[model samples]
Target chain A: DAGVTQSPTHLIKTRGQQVTLRCSPKSGHDTVSWYQQALGQGPQFIFQYYEEEERQRGNFPDRFSGHQFPNYSSELNVNALLLGDSALYLCASSLNGGVYGYTFGSGTRLTVV
Target chain B: GQQVMQIPQYQHVQEGEDFTTYCNSSTTLSNIQWYKQRPGGHPVFLIQLVKSGEVKKQKRLTFQFGEAKKNSSLHITATQTTDVGTYFCAGPYLSSNTGKLIFGQGTTLQVKP
Candidate 1:
């Protein structure tokens, strides 16, 4: 089965601009979550979506937002991007809140200049 | 906020040597999970430990959950070049059903052949 799929394997954006990254959850999964990973750092939780509604969020700023479609696809939007925003954005999917485990995508590398 | 901390931020060893990374959580975790991210790759699920003092093995890698449910460890026996990557330990923040995870800073391993 196809696992979680993310769009734009790599991207470059200017500071103060905006960016949108997309993700398609793995087949048979219903929940989607987003994470940010900097160089030499672990993935940090951003937010989670279930039933098209954001269920929980981490300590990210309001400039970071996300959406989950009815089909279980997700999009992460970052506004007013800064150089620090440059990192790998990962999308993970799970079945029934991921009590078992999570399936992660290849992730999108965002580079802000 | 809950936090997961890992020790020995980096490790380099010969292919025939062994390596282990430790993780500790500030709060009790319902379960702990292990993930491995190859260089320039997204994190992949390794395994999960739930019960207290639980242990699981996968090939040459072994995972352990302490009796207090707040610590974990990953050990590799006779590491190989393929084992070069960052290993992370994560725990669900509050409830497993929330789909929120707190991940450690990760332990990067380099295996020299």
Candidate 2:
């Protein structure tokens, strides 16, 4: 199993609602990044956090925002979610933003109805 | 804009057969990373290549980075049931190498024993 830990292995939500997903980095890790994986597609980078700050972001809108805590844990918040938002959310952790390769969590499956 | 692309979206191979997936990047990459995801599991880090014309091996799997640093490949010497999964290649954006990866579409491998 991946050393990283994530919460709410699965979730069902309605369109227009908001959702929050949490993640805890693996032991001794400090960088956390999030990805959204759609069915039959590759994972898409959302953003990355380092030292409790957002280091970089992807093409996603501001509605898909995230925060990293001092302990290297992170939260992904999506507002006004749409049906297209339904996908598997994956969390990966590493030292220096995956320069050493990333360790991923089981992921949270979000379904928007 | 940075992008990564993978070919042979799906491959079905018999046990003991060989398998290969190719990845290409829109821009030169400092390094390339490989990952594998099971049918219903999150992606797991497989390996990373840094130097040009570099190759690394792990048992039955072999990874190679191109001299141009814009292409890479993962080759399996002998496919096994346990090797069934989707393999992905990711690279940091050339504009911002702060650890945010631009992932490829990935290639799914189905190994029948």
Please state the CAPRI-style docking class of candidate 2: medium
Model 1 over residues A37-85: C-alpha lDDT tens digits? 9988889999999999999999999999999998999999999999999
Candidate 2: list runs displaced more than 4 Å: B95-97
Model 1 residue B73 CA deviation in Å: 0.5
Residues B20-97, candidate 1: write the lDDT tens digits: 999999999999999999898888999989999999999999999999999999999999999999999999987364
Q: What range of 10 consecutive residues in model 2 chain A has the weakest lDDT sum? A: A95-104
Which DockQ-derived CAPRI band holds candidate 1?
high
Q: How well is candidate 2 docked (DockQ)?
A: 0.80
State in Å the error of residue B109, model 1.
0.9
Each model's TM-score for chain A is: 0.98, 0.98
Q: Name the lDDT of candidate 1.
A: 0.94
lDDT of each: 0.94, 0.92
CA RMSD per model (angstroms) = 1.2, 1.0
